[model samples]
Target: MNTSIFSRFQTRSHGGITLRASAFAAILCAALHAHAAQDIYFNENTSVSSPNRYLNESSNWYTDAGRTQQFEGTLSSDYNGIINTESKISASCASELSLNSLTYNIAAAKDYNNYFASLADNASITLAEDFNVNITFTPETGWNIQTIRMFHNGRITVGGDFNLTFDKNGSGSNGFLEFVIRNDSASAALTNRFQVAGDFNYTAVESGSRLRFVTGIGQFFVGGAMDIGNILWTINNPSSSEGANISLGGLTGTSGMISLGTGMASTMTFTNSAQREAKTTIGYTGDETTLNVTMRASDAKNGYQILRISSGAYGATDANLGDVIIDTGRLDLGMHSGMKGNYLSIAGVDGVFSATASDSGNIGAATFENGEWYAGKIAIDIEGELAYDKIVFNGRFEKTGSDRDMGFEFAFDAYTMRELISAGRGEFILEDVITYETGSSMAGTVFEGNTSGIQWEAVFGDTSLSVSFTVPEPAAVAAVLGAISLAFAALRRGKRA
Candidate 1:
């Protein structure tokens, strides 16, 4: 599993972009990497490339250091390794070294680059257990992606799972390809896991040439479970920590753009609420930070709302931002407020958060977030049309926070319901999604069910509704539940015929 013949001289980069080639793509890198099949290189003109050289010695492994090309051990996936030398050796890189795709160049030797050996300057590596690398790319141009660059006082300790995978076909302009990690791990706090997880089946191509997944300082810790096709593209984490520890559980995705954050300090957390595939936007930034999301407004996904959170275009601020507890969700069509917070809770039991800022392209002022909400456990501000008792969300829910309540009930029926405003100053309604499609059917009320066996009224008029009643106590649809309207049936005319 160890072989030789990879000596091409270098300069490359990924995700953050930097792979300068044009001498005809560096003369098509030996015809797109044919560096003699089982190619391996890390001889950096020997001298041991520096310090303790002996990665299971094959003459200290070479492609050129006057050792006349070498390679006698370590590498699988039919071999093709290249680490244009940064020299430093640690024992058993997966049983004395392994690679199928490891190209972290320090000097271009024609980008068939490879290596995982990340230990910069104050270098350090202790692989006591696992260390697999089916992928990692920093050798660009001939884009067959692979990279592993963890600088600034680098250090690694993998007791298990450093598994890799990212083989995106980069196109013209040499169509970029990447799998980056500028991680600053000194064990960033212990036990390595960094698993990028399975199902990279690929197919989200729009390739104007810029495939991505960038990272830098979220410190490591992910053995698996990063679902949603494992965040395949466009994940830009612009470094910033001090108290920027990371943990994200139960995430669903269509996450087209996730920007992470800026100068973090307070804290960051997301334990639930994530179901995207319709205009996805999950952003974050500085200040007080307190994110907690649980879902149970019947977990909407098809009736409307998989996810919607916006600090607007990603600059977040109430002078820095924080606080988003949505017990269940909705919003995000337009009119965003860059999320300046002080409050936006809408939590549990009957918690149903929905905001439809005038539908039709939602031009403005809807998911308004500049913070002014102060409701807890009870907020029922029904302002028209929101059905999903299992599929019915014709859009329309606008909440601005702060109402005062302990109870509110309104079962809704749809087909264009009209008018209903039960403003909860103490915040009411935790168990009724929305009922008001907006006027006319003459305002409905004409049920002649079996008035004589042949009757049907409500072509679009009386569709069936129930903002029912109960806001602490206001009964009389027959004392609360006797009759809530919208009824039909009872046909028997066979005997007369």
Candidate 2:
């Protein structure tokens, strides 16, 4: 054969028979042409989302869910699939499947039902576009609350973003992302990951949305800002580096409340500023409905910060960390072994609001280990109020470090300081005597009681460093008291009846 002809002629073995490369290329093209881009619908679809669906079943799929347009091909990145079933437990074999998008679309004109979807073990899905959970309803019926319950024993990778936004003129909807791991060693693999390449923005989702981790080694990552509304994030995984983690790029935007609870040890980290300035309440991740809140050294294991400044995880500094409320839970900020649960890690706490009251002195709201909290480039504020009773603080509230100091302030109702001494605010816990590098100390006759608040200028006489406190009023105590009173009155009325 001539050199030119030989260059075009290559050998390939098919069924033990040699074939020219041109022939192999032609056959490959035909195979590739078989699966074309489509907006495919699962056969389980209905006007009112019902019936279950299978992701791996080919015969159960059709071109139209409402009509009999059977589709005879498997799903691919070139196709867009819809899961119109009320509940979807999709499983893929050992192979990887990538699609344009997946929607848990339960057709709605009636009251909303909680749609469910999860991946079985070893199953994986990659949405090349976005994973959207949407609901449509009439505005006159008010906000029709639609919810989607998410579960994962396997994996789901969203190429774009994941959102549960309202349809039909923004009626209303909420999505509950609960990680129902088997809590067994065989299930929670450290390598299991459920990631969103783009923002996991739930600004569209209404308040009271939840994302709880019962037990799972599946780590979740969000690539963009997490502008979610009010949310209560519960982390109940055991203490381990392999435990589940929810990572976010930034938590800016919404001023909605943020709450956290940790059972064993798990860390929820964010890369940049946590500057939403929302109210954060720390509570237990246990059964809040049936059991009462309890806090002890043993029950509170050593874990990292609830909203651990992931700047340190990525680079460093939650200088823009936001507001927090310790209303219904216990915060374990003690150092166990060499790692101090970064509850309010000094190295990253630009804003550590230690606000409290004296009513519920029963189960001290927050607990801290005996350690120092450094003020990065920003000042630190520890503000609290007082009643007739003492404000409770568990473990030890001691802190003093030679670390970087911007400044520290203890703005408290000093008049009630004497009453709180027995509960443990004996002295301004951050530091009794503000010592400067000049070997000089300042505190005493500044404001009132032991907590007169400290300033960089007052300590080192350096007026450059500024510190301020936005002392949140102690309404939590009154709120608790009112609720208690209401409950007692209701009981009395019932007994009379």
For candidate 1, lDDT tens digit of each residue in 20-67?
A: 444446667767776434655555533314443434345556654344
Tens-place lDDT per residue, model 2, 127-236, is: 88888765443443343333222233466788888775543433333333332332234454455566787776543334443333233444766765565434434433
Per-prediction CA RMSD (Å): 21.1, 20.8
Which lDDT values do the candidates have, in the order given? 0.35, 0.41
The TM-score of candidate 1 is 0.27
Model 2 gets an lDDT of 0.41
> How do all models score by TM-score?
0.27, 0.47
Q: Positional deviation of 122 in candidate 1, in angstroms?
A: 7.6
Query: What lDDT score goes with residue 394 in model 1?
Result: 31
Q: What is the lDDT of residue 136 in candidate 1?
A: 21
For candidate 1, what is the total of clashing residue pairs?
46
